[model samples]
Target chain A: MGPIMDLTIFGFLVQDGLTTGAVYILLAVSLVMVFTVTRIVLVPQGEFVAFATLTLAGLERGDAPGLAWLLVAAGVLAFVMDLSAARRRGSRRGIAAAAVLFLAVPAVLAAVALYGIGASTPLAAKIAVTCAMVVALGPILYRVAFQPMAAASPLYLLIAAIALHFVLVGAGLYLFGPEGVRTSPLLDGSTEVLSMPVSVQTLLILAASLGLNLALFAFFGFTLQGKALRATAVNRRGAELVGVSADYAGQLTFALAAAIGALSGVLIGPVTTIYYDSGFLLGLKGFVGAIIGGLAAYPAAAVGALLVGLLEAFSSFWASAYKEVIVFTLIVPVLLWRSLAHVAVEEDHD
Target chain B: MNRRNKSACAAVLMGLSCLAAGSAQADITVGVIISATGPAASVGVTQQRTVPLLPKEIGGERVNYIVLDDASDTTTTVKQAKKLISDDKVDVLLGPSLTPNSLALIDQMAETGTPMISLAGSGAIVEPVDDKRRWVFKTPQSDGQMARAIIQHMTSQGIRSVGFISFNDAYGEGWAASFRSLAEQVGIKIVASERYQRTDTSVTGQTLKLISANPDAVFIAASGTPAVLPQATLVERGFRKPIYQTHGVANNDFLRVGGKNVEGTLLPGGPVLVAEQLPDSHPAKAPSLEFIRLYEALPNAGMRSTFAAYLWDASLILKAAVPEALKTAKPGAPAFRAALRDAIEGVKDVVATNGVYSMSASDHLGLDSRSRVMIRIENGGWRLVP
Candidate 1:
């Protein structure tokens, strides 16, 4: 025990694992919440966060300190997009398509603004162009096409949405190449910024990430749109009879889910290097974590992610190669066990 | 009369098809069993990305790189290798990256006598299971060399007693055993040794197991995201003891995922980017830099790694071996390929733009003690420690 008490790399590894796990936890929980409300698993949740992070971080990151207002504005727009999608209860595929476009809007706007900055265009002109495009074209198109599509089943729709996300990412990769990462710099000269021992900044990054997710959830839960979403989720006919406007509520929930997916991508981008495939992997992990948490339970998925992280850390130390194999193997057995137990309980009830 | 006409038509059609096939045999075919997906797909992707840029001036002749995706699976590797050889009739071969896949191909290599080179890691890939077979050659150092390098570096830094953390696979087990042997040879003791399976991500039990027995430095012999990131977890928890990493975990992706936790970790040097910044007189510096510059210009590729230096040398050796095909064997494709193999086998002391490389009948390992350089992370970048 005394010798064990001496410092070791595995100890440090466990700590790092926890930190990364914390980030995963948030993603897992958000995904789980969306799944719980809609009954459709949002398998694409991970990719959404990655894309949103890339979108925001891809903005004029050099001036990000001053563009605090931009984030607020983007968040509100994203939230509105969420509400609209929630109002729609269209086919899963159509909703997914609409959601993909909704997420892309911010990234495109951010890209245009950043491109303008790079090309020596005046800030006012960039913002003017951005605002005009977003308002004049973005909302009009979204209202017509995406709003209805989103109200459909959230589960299968989640998968379709993520596949659409991959296409967008692929397009971005084709257009940006390696420079896409550079065009808007995810973090302000990461080497310098990351080096500064401002634990406060790290805390803020983590806190803001968590807070934004929670705040969005709160908006959905506390607001009238959120109430409508609940009514649609629990029972459509009853909610409609209660004058809840079930169709509108459906659209609002889809819109909210899309917004969450987009904002998540924005927050995650600065933490890791973005690539065409980044979204897909994150989406999968988030989906898995969501499932582990019973889909409807946000806090459970959060815990599941931390569990994944902790397991990952331990697995690396013990069986590095089998880390993934072990996690998946356990997942299947656990699920099988649960299914068997459920059957047994049903038999007892009979 | 109708039957005769039909028979005549069939004969003519078959004859024409055969003639067309022979007419299209202008390009030399070379097969690469590359990993297009899975964990090590990045390495395979890098190879696919880099191999095409070899100029015709260097390649002697442009060959159809019949790259078949192995999916990083053994069955896929075997099937792809068979198809390339039997179906594609490839002139030369490269890669089936992982150890098990490489080992699986040994009997095939011996039977076919195919002169193959791998753009893979796994010290055991080229090492003979039996002395009669010497057809395989590996571009990277063997496990023995890697273990020696790790032990030597750690001991020199006064890390006498080290902890062992490795995956329980062929790759990991081989390294773990070799490391213990190498460490014991140098009078270094391994205090705590723990083994874990590949898929288990929560190493809490394992890490706790290792930390419980604690040693001076911990040797993490692992690869891919699942294996490497846990080291970061250990570091962040304030474990300051020297955490020495295997050569496998020395890439940018690993460093990126590990972040500051990797700042002080030591990595065995395979090739450093400093070679690019150096002048001509410095052995490998000039040629390495030239390759980097040329490779950077490849569409969608850039100058990103120090390891690409070895690849440059590997291509150069193969290129220089081409002239032997003209001299020793006949002028045609098949004979020239036969000569190319012999020339490669006979290569010795050919001063590459980098350092002196010697290849022969018995010697598979390229460089001796002078070649195995070591480096450590200072401020998020790898720096050679004197």
Candidate 2:
């Protein structure tokens, strides 16, 4: 008990917490964006993390991942759907564009992956290729699973998200067996900061997370497309009436969420071992952070995720067995406070 | 006419009796339940691979092995055990790999009056020799034995204080309990003790707390690839003290996942892990070499695992007991199970791949300090240490 309160221990806990918090912050921001624009929780966000890590590991071993094949299949399916829709709507140009973007993009990525296998590719290339492969999965997933049900009730979308999580988890197990894999660190060295040692990989994680957050801020604040997404989040029917394509906003949000999840996977793969089923728990922690922000504000979710990470670190030291319980219990207070502060209003129908 | 009919009746009766005697000497069926697809799959895979290497005929009786996957779930283990007993009518039961799965099937085994040779490492599987556990036996050395070996090594190194990071499961708690009592006996104080889940992504916080205690060494009581998490985190946080792991992680996957981080780490393992490196005069050498030869003969056999040797030893015990049991009662009968149990208990000085096993009414595991050897990870392989 006496040693638990030591300042040095506190500092170490903070460092550890922030390192993990950075990844959770990315996940929380993705969750907030996806929920705000689409009114659906991205339950399978962790699957992207697992796929990215596994893909990187496969590349390190000089083997092409099964994800390469999955991506191509999804791309082909999405293109077929788009082509039929365009033909029905008498838009020949749309069909041609869809074929190039969906079919050609995945075909090129798959070819690169096949060529990279058994070859000594650069690490940056592997990282970029894996991230792109996973991000490319986003639009296809939206077109297949969510786009048709875009106007469904939030409860119905939540159920669909959960179902998608199971499908991805089953697919992950089939693709990457039950064995856990760890990749070599992207940056492999440590340095002392204020008498505390920190690894270069940890620094990379912090920097990358900061960069992504800033990029997201700029994307949402300045770009016309970002404003359209914001308008949809504020009032979906109003945005639709104003000629902003709801489908585009939904697809973009999912794409952003997928990219964030994959990047988080690549960043943390070296820090911890990742298994096929590991993503669900990690994503749940992010969901907890999202809930703390009332599922609306990005900055609040980021701060909440950092707090969750810090609490997790400190509580593990104090009571390791109950650390999960303590971290999850935080949401109860936040929920109670929000419920008491805000008056209930019935949601408007379309 | 009467003499001719009488002679024909005697000949027919003799032929029927001979046929009955031949049918009584049929195959002995051993049902195996192992986790081939879940968290324990790494360990269970090796155990499963050993099944093909078992002798097809034990004492002139053809042995039929029925293997089922429990998926590392305790309820599934019990269900599989029940199905093997009632449906397959297996003469004896072989496994239910992990500790929790093995422990869960104890009652079911006792109720069914079938002998279970478990491959798990927990002492509770055979300890106290209660009515329920009397039907159960395990091949791996008990946690208590390995704990004492670690404590002795620590004492010889002049280590007075140690920290522990254990998994929050039965295996972890079992080691923590044994390690605590053994360290106390050796005058070593436990400075810090922490627990983490097997699926936990990061143990940095727990590891930092452990380092803050400033112990001379830290012992991690986790198994498989997950065991690498805490140790790696400790190194990341710059803890330069000696680190030790439990025998549960004595496999190639641990070394692979751990990479450079686990070099020079110490752990106690079965002699089979570093069989080639052991001295020729060592008791485990001959049997260990034979197991390696037979296992490696199979196409695509990757690396020799100590977990596989546990099943190999179980087969050895079965090989010695099957003949004795066959003499008393036919296979799959109530009397046959009782006889097999007694025969296994009566086995004496049987050299197995892991160690020389000698089971008794009070002792089911039958291995001692001779079964364990201290090992270190050097150059990505297990090195035998003095």
State what share of the real interface contacts each candidate retains: 0.17, 0.66
* Model 1 agreement with the true structure over A151-223: per-residue lDDT tens digits: 5555445555555555545543443222212122224322232333222323444566578667767876798
Q: Residue-wise lDDT of candidate 2 within B262-339, one digit each (tens)?
A: 988999999998999989888889999999998888767788988889889999999998899989998878789888
Off by over 4 Å in 2: A4-6, A80-93, A117-119, A192-196, A345-348, B1-25
lDDT of each: 0.56, 0.85
Give the winner by lDDT.
2
* Candidate 2 structure, TM-score to reference: 0.93
**Alpha carbon lDDT at B282, candidate 1:** 52
Q: What docking grade applies to model 1?
A: incorrect
